[model samples]
Target chain A: MNHVIEIDGLTKDYGEGRGVFDVNLTVEPGEIFGLVGINGSGKTTTIRHLMGYLRPQKGTCSIEGRNCWKHAAELKKHIGHVPGEISFPDVRTGMDFFNLQARYLGIRDKTRVNSLIDRFNLDASAPLKRMSKGMKQKTAIVAGFMADAPILLLDEGTTGLDPLMQKVFTELVQEEKAQGRTMFMSSHMFDELEATCDRVAFLKEGRIIDVVDMSLLGGNEPVKEYKVEFTSDEDYQTFLAQSFLVKRHRDDYKQVSVLLSDRDLNALFASLSGLDVRYITQVPRTLEDQFKEKYQESEGTNHAY
Target chain B: MPINSALLRQTTRENVTLWGVLTAVQCLLVGVIGMTAPIAAAGIAYYNMLPGIFMGVYAITVGNKLISSQVDRGTLAYVLSNPVKRSTVIVTQVVFFAGSLLAMCTLSAVAHSLGAYFSTFGANSAEIQTIFKLNLGLFTLALSFAGIVFAASCLFNLSKYTIAVGGGIVCAFLLFPIMAMFGSKFAFLSNLTVVSLYKVGSIMASGTGWAWDLVILAAIGLVAFAAGGVAFVRRDLPL
Candidate 1:
């Protein structure tokens, strides 16, 4: 499959259901993959395995066909990483850190660094220990993206950035994506994942629930969902008796959510004609909604899998 | 070597201020006391006890902060993310630390020589040689102490545990000698500490046994540092 990053049965058991279990994943070249999970759900654990910071207990993680643990130093040359926690060294200022990193990474070009600083509006002259949380995050972002490596790994990539800065960061990521750079990122914000990821994996209780292709959720002719509240009780009953699929309903508010394919718009309009409707609004079926559905479905099965 | 260069520079810059203060205190102690007290007594107090204690403190600080503290605070991930081997990081720290100790010891020796010349009203070659031998003993002792704490740093993931065990052993090494000075009963305790390997009075009296002292001290240092390297390479970092 020409996978740039591969994990086969990677398991690290900290005991008491606290670690990743048999996580198998493959990220193809130039693919933007996203890992979505709440805190302590093994997202960071999986990323640390990929970074070679933690050794797997059972299986192997590799990058470009080299074992992550055995050839970590060599593999690092091809990877740029932004850790979940931002902790700078004892360097006096951000510029000092950047220069140190440049020398360590053997990067002779400083132009990329200066441009990243300008794009993020970062103050590289300020002392690292004294910088605010947002500034520290921005500095880490600049450092990670400046090298322009073919493969990038970011854990909670935009946690502390303000809305405007988050927009800038996502724009930078999109540009990297457009250049065919392979990326694996984890985030708490579903919108960020939906905006940049080709495929997103949901992790729950240290297990991967599913990996969803964004295209499958309706690419060009995406399915549309709507919530309509009929003004009259009789109209609401009549609409409920129709053949349209009612995904959810609120009896008190006389509102029902209906899922329809893009081609079914005319049929939907015809079905609603001459009906006393109070209001109708489109319901965006986001990554969060998918995540919630997966969780609910899993619970409903009662360990059927 | 390139990977180590940047790390060395950063460590040196962060450590210079505290090192400067230690150096000034050391130079002043040997330079001032050597002019007033008997040369032998001055060497024992300023050269043997004072610098030994200071070096012990410095060794523990470097040993703990250089690796374990960074790991505990999650900062080591940044350094390891670069194209640097784990072995390279530990080796670079040991080299930088040993060089700093050697420089401080040499400066102490120079300060001691200056004091001895003024006290004797002439340049006493014999006293200067005695100071040089004593400084060598102190440097090796310092190296041994550093290796011990550094090994502790490598064996543990948490800085608190490293500091507790490493700092406790160093404290005992420092205290045993001070207590031994009171009487003969406590003198046996000195043999249990590295400070006993540095026989300042006996070395100055005979002038020929300093070779064996250096060898033993070097042996202690090499063994401890090698053990530390193995532990660090084999250990799994939680970051």
Candidate 2:
């Protein structure tokens, strides 16, 4: 796969208190790559470096084989960037901004611009200051899409959007993916990412703790969650003691839910051959669960966010 | 050329509302001031009142806002993210602003020349030339102020700090000459300020002093622009 963005040992320090440390990551061409992390995880910093808004203090970040800082204008031609905050001059209407951006990007497609306006449901006549957060976000997104650049760098693109707009955005991203455009998105929302991104890199304190390929994780053997209803309390206790499955939750003496991997499930069935078995229901691991596990393992602590 | 025009169009479009209102207010103030004192009226007609007023306001208003607005509106990140070089952006902004100021100054000079010709005590050819020189000197002063402020704005990211430093620098330039007049020993101090250039222009329509002032202004403007470009190129923008 062609790598669209390649970052190696990128470091940025804002005084002594804040900034990103040596960071490395890559986004392949035509892939929707997600950067997932909590607030202050250096997600935005990395995006800034990739977009050439910030020069890396050390190492290199390149887009399409061009070092972003050194070849910013050339790299910018191939990339469309959306900042975390969408702000424009209060005096300019949406149409004015669109016209300026279109002219700058050398776009002459009025139909495409109008189509984007319709897709995002933005009011072209309204001044930028009057638009709602979601509308502003849509404007920025439309502007990015209008550039028709091969790469899209979005920093927390869906933070302020409502659920409906978020869904629309996800669909729009999917559409872009279909067109073979590469998207590198930094978002705190795991569910939104799970819906669209092909792969995700989990960043923790400026370092990528895990990079999960969604396809591989989703293709892993489906682990079935079974809550065996025992006839007697003693039988339940005996079965629980013998079972090697990871206990997820326990409600009562006779009621317990445990997560079982494929091998554990097979062993569980073989062991409970004679006992009355309860109905078995399959529960697949979500991206959130996988992420939580990785985060916990990496940090050696459970953080509830 | 088209790209440059497009960028110029963007800057013009963004500033139209504010600059339009400011220009109107300045014209009104000049008219009102012209009516107050007869001698001052001759000064206005002969010395080109509009350019002086416009330059003063433009230096304080648009000059201060040029870079501060980018940081205030959070569009700096988006603009800097583009493929364009940092130096290109700085140069474009400086040239656009300086060109605009020059145009206004030239127009005001023409208007003053006409106003003097039609006034009760009309200005002669020499007076018209002197007014022209004063306007030119003022334009350079304003342009230099813009450059200095632009540099300050770039050096400091915070809008409040940029404004403070920019305003303080301009104020110092304006006040140093007045303060130097009080003490004979301190008279030389005025030579260090941009106000000295304006004084020389007012005294001599065509002289080596004005030429030196223009050169110094251009050099300072170039240095300010270069510093801003370097800072922008080197500093990491907050994402």
Clash pairs for candidate 1: none
Q: Write the per-residue lDDT of candidate 1 for residues B84-171, one digit (tens) a residue.
A: 8999988888888888889988998898789878875544788788888888888899988988888898888899988898878888
Q: What TM-score does prediction 2 earn?
A: 0.88
lDDT (Cα, tens digit) per residue for candidate 1, span A1-305: 77899999999999998999999899999999999988999999999989888889999999999999888888889899999998898888999999989988989999999999999999999999899999999999998987878999999999889999999988999999999999999987998888889999998877888898886653332677889999998888989998898899988899999988878878877988989999988886678888888988767776786
- Residue A305 C-alpha lDDT in model 1: 64
Error of 1 at A75 (Å): 1.6
**Regions more than 4 Å wrong, model 1:** A218-239, A242-244, A250-256, A259-284, A301-305, B1-3, B124-126, B182-185
The lowest-lDDT stretch of 10 consecutive residues in candidate 2 chain A is A216-225
B123: Cα error in model 2, Å? 4.5
Candidate closest to the true structure, highest lDDT? 1
TM-score of each prediction: 0.91, 0.88
Worst 10 residues of 1 chain A by lDDT: A215-224
Top candidate (TM-score): 1
lDDT agreement of model 2 with the native = 0.72
Model-by-model lDDT, in order? 0.87, 0.72
Steric overlap count per candidate? 0, 1
